[model samples]
Target: MKQTQFKLICTLMAAVFTVSQAAAQTKEKQIFLSPPLIRSIYTADPSAHVFNGKIYIYPSHDIDTAVTDNGSGDHFAMRDYHILSLDHINGPVTDHGVALDIKNIPWAGRQLWAPDCAYKNGVYYLYFPVKDKQDVFRIGVATSKDPAGPFKAEPQPIEGSFSIDPAVYTDSDGQSYMYFGGIWGGQLQQWATGKYQPNGSKTDLQNDDAPALSCKVVRLSSDMKQFEGPVKDVIILDESGRPLLGKDHDRRFFEGPWMHKFKDKYYFTYSTGDTHYLAYATSDKPFGPFRYKGIFLKPVQGWTTHHSIVEFKGKWYLFYHDTEISGKTHLRNVKVTPLYHRSDGSIALIDPFKSK
Candidate 1:
């Protein structure tokens, strides 16, 4: 089916179900026109991929806070990941449960944040970041043969991953890059007793922040185990080539670095916090001089907005999460909507919560 026709059919099917008595049924018995994609539990930080004709989503699973909340200063305290897949755009979603868990990872603590997956040489690599036993953040790589599977994670994290939100981008020329980091704030440290520690200041977060962070992009080696080159900093630049993120620059990356290749351009996208919004930058080169484009999605109805974009079968969709159903910032549900691009290569802003 063509992309346009498939979307129209989906919209029509959703419309049909809302007019009937079936809408009043219990959560288990009800027929939903557009239900939350994963019904069993809250799933956030969606990373959608097209693998072997199926759309597979690898997202951080948000369980109830009672299980583990070690006072990381953040509400989200995820311990495992679930890989969800759909056969087609309008098909039912299947949850491939517990692809990777922290119990198996010796060095990992609680607080599993955003994760992304990439396929290379018959191996599916699940890249994720989690706080260590000491409450410090780091990124790790897990491997699986099947798209949805019991992925085996490396005992330790990637050599020097002291950040969050790991997003992997495999370019057309067979080169792969990993983009990861947090917002432009000083790295905060805390005691296991939920108290802030003093005399632990390392890097000051400001406009003059080091080039290594502020959204760094580095080339990955063929084995996908280590970095291959100098870590390139990706900050928005002014017309005269001066850095523009912390000062004057409207769209600085808070977290969630997603790299997409549209036509001949590289779209470097991320989410901004404090006042959240989904935004992007474009560049001709993968190791970018990425100029900041305007916001592609105004913040969803949530405290934090993290997303990944994928084009499946000629249709483009933005995979993001929101707290509409859960009513709490920590318990977020994933949302998907069709995305369009302007003729000039900029993406059109989308409201993910708009009614069908």
Candidate 2:
């Protein structure tokens, strides 16, 4: 759809949902919308799974801030894991307990981010990011026998250079693949937990094999113990093909690329426009010639969304963090929408909650 037509449709849906929002204002009443799912789980970077008849939400717990109460000192930006489940994703959600935590793992006391889970054989592996004292960030894998479990976490980290926002994908070949790294060069050495040194504390610490690209992905060993190769680079925004996005635009892009295969074709979704909006690209191969799809979503009720997408109950939902309170924390909200594909090959997201 053209931008103008898309705006009109969104505006109409917004008006229809405005009444529902007002009704939801009373504390005794609950809205049919997506979040404040876990009020205590001050959220961001969400990962969802359908296991054992429930939709489990594993999100980055906002455990730290500059202030004493909000800030978890040692684990900077602690992504302490909390669980919330919903019998019917279309309605009321339930809160479970703290499934995993950083303080409990004293050896690597650091902040964790974007915990994602997948069930293989009989084990549920949770993938997330953490920063050690030197501020060097890496992804960690923990296994649980059950979705809601006594998770056994290992002290050893997933060996990779400056890896964070760990996402594991099990390909058709029975090969496990992980995609991570951020706008700021993926392999950059941490000076102190999520904080990077300008000079990159360790030379060649980022990746022994990657040339100069910031983001990388690689095949995982069958056991998911290590990478088969160096962190492979993906989504290098060097040009826009449009002259406006010259060399300058390449440097001014946000990086977070997540992919899923549909009908043998790879659909890669990424964060861009300063992470306020999501755009997509697709390719026949896992690697590129990835043509830009277009904007997936823009500001909602004047809110910016970031880092979220999932397929649950045979439907696709986009989960992102909105800057509801300006400079304050970005509270994570899950917006369940039906993703439609256009004949022209563009992806359109219809906000179901707001439409009716």
Candidate 3:
């Protein structure tokens, strides 16, 4: 009887051990799968690039503030920039700390929105948009010797640049161009007459049947300091080649412009602001009359969606942000997932929360 009882006790202990081991394995997998890639702080508007063979993310540092959301984007309240980097796609991300701050910029008033970076002649140029003392948004450029930077801002905003969300794309042959502008709170509407109007329409063109406003693009000077020529409009067209109308909220360019080249074709992707989608358009040339492609990313658990597409180790990845962690639009978190391009060139649609 004693031996039988001892044997029963041993079996129970073994069963308990197995159950604990299985639970631990499940926890490990959950940690690896959960996102907000950098959990130390709130971040948004990820501008990802592969620099020196490492994936570097330049994102707006979102801060908790009492300011309320309004037509002029007063609630975003981003005051600094932080750079995040990773050695591998799913590997650990390192926050390199503040790259630039509002206090250091000589001409900035507030709200340093989405920014992009470009590398040329051994320098990294950080291009951002902020309201000036006159309360108009103007694009600005800052420089750093390191991709993970303690960057120095140019004393003035880019001479002819206006609006927001500056995305710089450098072509294979070596020239670089900047695509910028946004509607609604980004104040793209205020510049409708090609000049800043204090009483300009609070939103877009406002006529639903009218053609939507166009984002602006300009070739960068060799020094990467200023625009080389006049800023031109980047037109987005429908399947029939007609301009997408203002009523098409799901397809029109609202804010957050990103340009990436895949298979020698230029893909211009932007946020469909009110609709909360990441949509793309394709063009044969860098300066585009791009044909609108369907949505690539569905609405996330956030009111805003901004992203960047980059290739690392021959695999494509999409870096974007959502309000999943903080559950507040003004406080966001960045996330990443694999992005696949179909054989016919259309991007495979991504549902960010769908289980793999």
Looking at model 1, report the run of 10 residues with the lowest lDDT sum. 184-193
The per-model lDDT (C-alpha) reads: 0.72, 0.55, 0.85
Which lDDT tens digits does candidate 1 get at residues 84-154?
A: 99988768889988999889888988777888999999999998888788777778888999989789989
Error of 2 at 39 (Å): 2.9
Estimate the lDDT of model 1.
0.72
Global CA lDDT computed for model 2: 0.55
Backbone collisions counted per model = 0, 9, 0
Name the best candidate (by lDDT). Answer: 3
lDDT of 1 at 117: 92
lDDT at 14, model 1: 40
Pull out the clashing pairs in model 3.
none
Q: What TM-score against the true fold does each predicted structure earn?
A: 0.81, 0.72, 0.89
lDDT of 2 by residue, 1-356 (tens): 24564455345434533442343233123223344454555665666667886777777766535542111123235646776678865667665677888875544546676667777778888776776656566677778888876566777777653556666667687777777664333333332234445444322222333322334567877666667886554543323532113123223224455667766767766654222456676667665545555567653422223454666767766665532322233344443444666666667853323333
Two-way lDDT contest, 1 vs 2, winner: 1
**Judged by TM-score, which candidate is best?**
3
Clashing pairs in 2: 64-72, 65-71, 134-191, 134-192, 135-190, 135-192, 135-193, 216-232, 217-232
Pairwise TM-score winner, candidates 2 and 3: 3
lDDT of 3: 0.85
